[model samples]
Target: MQREPYRLVHSVSSKFREMNHKIGLFGGIFQYAWNNRKVVKNEDDETIFVLVVKRYTTKHEPWNYIRPYEILRKCEK
Candidate 1:
């Protein structure tokens, strides 16, 4: 049987995006789309695969943070 992808959620600061861009860690060039929630990218000519689950913006709230989830891996049933 097919497995389900792992999911994780956490609250993060808004500066995460700026830091990523400055460091060029997760801000990789688009390589291709894997599925609905997964994508492959190239960072410095190296393959980088990422699976994003969900994203939420708290701009209008009393916080300067965002909640994003990632699917790290899949497990067999």
Candidate 2:
């Protein structure tokens, strides 16, 4: 038997134009195309991958001056 590697990905609205945005599709078993979305990039390497979100939220509401990471961490717990 063979096994395939697994990866984790997360995004709200895609910043790249080539990637189509599937709004409100952030749970599981569904994906849309994305491009050039990585912390580090190599020249001539334009690869795309699937993105999965552990948790998601809408920023429509105002926060009490708290950072986003802090809020995400609290939500994870």
Candidate 3:
């Protein structure tokens, strides 16, 4: 079956929009380690940003990290 192309709506940061325009979906996966550090990269094997996941009594807080897809969907609202 054919799939629709992914498009980023408005409201996303210019950085993400620029990246998405330059490269197709910043292709990469979130990598986790025992240290609670997450690394983000792009399809060209480049590091985008590094995040630290902190555990709290209520929820886990991720710092310096934004899900690639979430950025796209955010414009929907």
lDDT of 2 by residue, 3-73 (tens): 64443233333332112222223311123333334455552222321232222224222222224423442
What ranking emerges by TM-score with the best candidate at the front?
Answer: 3, 1, 2
Instruction: Estimate every model's Cα lDDT from 0 to 1.
Output: 0.28, 0.30, 0.37
Point out the higher-scoring one by lDDT: 1 or 2.
Answer: 2
Model 3 residue 38 lDDT?
44
State residue 26's C-alpha deviation in candidate 1, in Å: 11
TM-score of each: 0.17, 0.17, 0.17
**Per-residue lDDT over 1-77 for candidate 3, one digit per residue giving the tens place of the 0 to 100 score:** 49754555554567666656432322222233323444434322123232212322124323333465447535653
Cα-based RMSD of candidate 2: 17.7
Model 1 residue 43 lDDT score: 38
Clashing pairs in 3: none
lDDT of 1 by residue, 1-77 (tens): 48754443332344555544432322221222222323434433222332311111121222221122122122221
The residue ranges of model 2 lying beyond 4 angstroms of the native Cα positions read: 1-12, 15-66
Query: In order, what is each prediction's RMSD in angstroms?
Result: 15.4, 17.7, 13.2
